[model samples]
Target: MLKQTANMQSSNWIGHFIKITAALTAVFILCETVLYLTNPNNRWTLVANTSLKDGISNSLVYPAYAVDVAFQDVEEYPLTEPLIVNPLPNIINDVVLPQNDTFLPVHLVRFYFGLPHGDSHSFCWIDCISILSIMLYVKPSKIYIHTNYPDYWPFGRCDMITDWSLIQLVYTRQRFHLSGRRITFYKHEADVTKYSVAYQYGGIVQDSDVFHLPKMVELLRDWKNKKYQCLLTREDHFMNSGFIACPKGHPYTHDVLLRYRDDYRDPPVLYNSADVPWEIYNKNKDYQKNFFVDYQMGNHSWDYKGPIRYKEIPAWHAYWHGCDENEKNTVQLAKNSTYWEMLHFILAEGRKALIAVFPTTVKP
Candidate 1:
């Protein structure tokens, strides 16, 4: 009787073991399938190998996905060959050109925003207005928003934007974190991303808080004509990285990237984005002459009660500074302010008209 009971117990144990193994195997297969479907590299490969038209269609279907997936892959796997510098064509003197004429080569405007703590994905009124200003004034071929979280769309005031075709989201990893430190600053990560994007793709890198003006068009033309390696703006006594424009494979941007990679120090030291560029400016005397630096780019005063500089209003920062966090209040302020009329004029009469009939002072 004892031998029979032992035999039954052994059979039950073996059956349970087999069932557990099968369950684990099924789980593993399911996980692998999910990974294969969602992996960015695999998706990028499938899209990149397709025809150009099909690739564009696929990107349009998912606007928030990384449009520069191939670039991201290249970064992951370092290229052995030297980086190529494609010379940009000069802009024609006349603004209006023939239908077949290509004005510039793929002007890419980039903005970087990081969502570290998984906080709100919604953009503030200031951000919305700033982007709207860029779309209206800069007339970029494409605007890429590089962020750690690519799934940040459909939140906040994005509905306010009418056109979604030109905008894209790119996934980027944070580069400025200490090995064992728990603290990370979003500002540093943004700095690194902007420099990297400018070096890799060659275009304008703008801060979310800064507004674009018609004057920027002229600066871009100068960049192309003079063959300036990079463009920066001066705010007060120091150079501000709020706005940076460069062509791909420029040594200026590459130097900034190298500085970040090698000399990046944790917070409290505070010298990465604007400071590094300023340092480069001081070190290289010729850089000052070669790189275009405009004083009017970031001239907006921080104090809400301070006088508003009419001339510097185009590339102003923090237009909604002093307004309540409520969106309605912001909208009302805009309607009551000269900015409303200014925007209307730009949209209706066009940027050229606005520049021709420049206003000295605007009343709220």
Candidate 2:
């Protein structure tokens, strides 16, 4: 009887232990699920069922990641999603063309076509974006682009595109021949930075991948001639390097070159080399090398900087450039259809606004 009683007690204890372990596992899973849902950029809907409004609150925790995930989804799957972007009118249906008497703002355009034969792929997209941006956001005097294929520009849409402005050190007859890799990626971008310094035009230079938003010109106008050399915007989670505003010839462009040269000499010494995070970019030697390191003196200026001012107008915008199989599939799909339409819709609206706002007193 005693042996039988001991056996029963042991069995009860084992059962209790199993039950506790199972309960703990269930709690852990539930907590993890809740955490994931709270992240705005997690794309929980892609994996589980969730509404965007509910996701918005969760987005506060992982704001950058949440935004990136949300934008990526919107950019890729715009067709399935609603066309209602709050606060901004839909351009496709309500395009506002310029009236008979009004002129447009002095246009400012720049291009980034670093990839060779990238003109057809990257540069072509940039030209379209530039035209669309000029039409929608601000009136540019002329959009200047730096590419090997200037012949491919849509001259019908643009008024004119003059010759290249900056000195071409890499492609010059004998100045300094760049390796194929540099030509493929960094050469044209470096040239654009130089051009921004050399040209006195107040327009910003941008990479081909940028997508413009409404009120972009107003933002630039607000920052004109204050002593800050360069201005940039934020993207989903980090600062977008593209879309910088400066006079035709800003002095800091030279600083950019010096930093680039130093970076080349010591790969780990500069900001965000071809491969690294912003943490590396901020603390690197290049930051010190820059002439405009003083924030008070107004050397480094950006629309969004630091943790406090994170929600201002995005200075550097991010598009659906995806990584991984799932993300790539979604990104490519949206790039084909929904992305262009929404972008064009925004552009059309902006053009009308530009026409209404363009300076009538200035000469064409």
Candidate 3:
């Protein structure tokens, strides 16, 4: 009887061990499947983390707010080593076709803000820092700033930026049928219009909040020589609309505008401004050939390997919800050594740094 009882006990233990092993195996497979289905080309996807140490990109971040997946299996362009870029300055409104070495000849750096006055303006010093950074690095022949409050901050200060002027940028708002209702968002308007405006005008369309670095000068200059028609980047899983550059009359830029217009021509909008441009480009073979991998040009600069060329809102523009957390992040990044170094330290330390300095109830 004792021997029989011991035999039964050993069998039960073995069964439990097999069950646990199978469960763990299934979990591992599920995690890999999720990663495979989400990223393009099965390459690295930018997952948000506090630091660069460890393989965070490969790990499942499983962010509560982040579940949106886009354009799976699409091959992404690769960014070769940085070359010495030179922005061939074209005469504003009179772009000269290069007789010999006319690559990406664009001299106008354009920025637009709908409301520049009253409490609704929402332009803060952090915003100013980004714009100032762009102006200092890009070194464009002419800077065209379009704002409702032409008399406000950056308009009259031509001396502040290298070259500055005001242009009347007006757009008739269009309604989109999204989430079972007609909606009009400023970002949506900026999305389609940016392509249209940039195509005709011939320049770089930059957001007011896009921070620039000195290293970007050479990269942009080299891009001109490479015959790249347009350079766009991804913010997380979607192609970002906040920053884009194109020489005058680039076909890719024109096609993107047409696609966006056609998609919303009727009803039931599928993609947002950021996703729309990417979808259009992904279908085109020619555009892919001229593409470049730009880690720094993206909304999240610290995710990839490069100098932090641009500064953007971490998750979304509305992530902070006016709770002062955004400002805290901005302030934190501004301190210490180079912006890159400061950002690296903050990301590595994660919530601890936030708690130490700007102790908040908010949890990362």
Candidate 4:
């Protein structure tokens, strides 16, 4: 009787072990599938077709927000060499572009916001650092800033960031924080129309909150010589104004700014428009009547036509933006992700250095 009881116990233990192993294996497979399917690059269909656009003649082709996946793959298995950021040698040739200097070099710009006015200082500062890490990595030539303020405050306090001169460039602030920066931003004016007046030549504009990957500058230089006068970025099915490139004084710059301003005037009845899916800007009533009218330049739809206008360039960071916790996590994860690692390699030898960040609310 004792032997039989022991045999039963052994069988039960083995059975439980097999069940546990199977469950773990299933989970591993599921996780891999999820990551693969959701990867932004894997879904190439999400990007607009490039073949239809005209190529720049004698101009260097600067790619926007686009990263080659193979480059990222190689970076994952880096050799023992110490990691350092450096510019690619002969970037003009490596990127496959003829040199043209008639056009001024384009500078891609983005800004960083810590949090809404009323959020906890800890949360807001963490948010600011998360953006700062990526900005330090990109080291852009121009930066525009928008934040909240009591107009002035003690150093280290959350509202202290309102001092715009700290970050430099053109600065503005919202009247209230609870207004939601996006809504408040829509209410204010955009500098797009003032490109000619503000800049000697046109430069690119990128939303400050987005993160970047490697060799982005090379891509920008590559297309500079191209005939296209402007470039727009897309996130899957949506076209985003967040990333834009135009020559100084280009007509499109003024057009886009004027259109956005008009939209802000009456605003699309946003409260009634929540049902529109994320990234579908055209479907929004305000955008439909104004921004989406022209399909060739890029319509209101998320997935517009290929090879944007001569005034338009391809945009890469179309999939990410805004301040939701999930969006913020993705941005943070990217801070240490393989994407930025390659950038660290490419950025190691660049000339630009750290600049002071000023509060936006304070006037010069």
lDDT (0 to 1) per candidate: 0.54, 0.36, 0.45, 0.33
Candidate 2, residue 180: how far the Cα is off, in Å? 13
lDDT of 2: 0.36
**lDDT string, candidate 4, 14-48, tens digits:** 99999999999999999888865664223332222
Candidate 2 residues lying further than 4 Å off, grouped into runs, are 1-127, 154-202, 225-229, 234-239, 265-316, 319-344, 350-364
Off by over 4 Å in 3: 1-122, 148-183, 265-272, 299-364
Model 1, 1-364: lDDT tens digits are: 9999999999999999999999999999998888656644234222232221233222321323222221221331234323211111111112221222123222222233423222244565556656666776677766777554455562255434555676766555443243223226666555666666666666678777676666666666667676676778876656676677876556677667666645666664347676777788878877877887777656556544344343344466543422234444545554666544343433443444334445543211
Sequence-dependent TM-score of model 1: 0.59
Minimum summed lDDT over a 10-residue window in model 4 is located at 67-76
lDDT by residue (tens digit), candidate 3, 119-183: 34444434443444544456454445432223445433222222233222232222233222344
Highest lDDT model number = 1
Whose TM-score is greatest here?
Answer: 1
Candidate numbers sorted by lDDT from highest down: 1, 3, 2, 4
Candidate 1 at residue 339, lDDT?
A: 48
- Residue 154 in candidate 1 has what lDDT? 27
Return the TM-score for candidate 3, rounded to 2 decimals.
Answer: 0.48
TM-score of each: 0.59, 0.39, 0.48, 0.35
Sort order, TM-score high to low: 1, 3, 2, 4
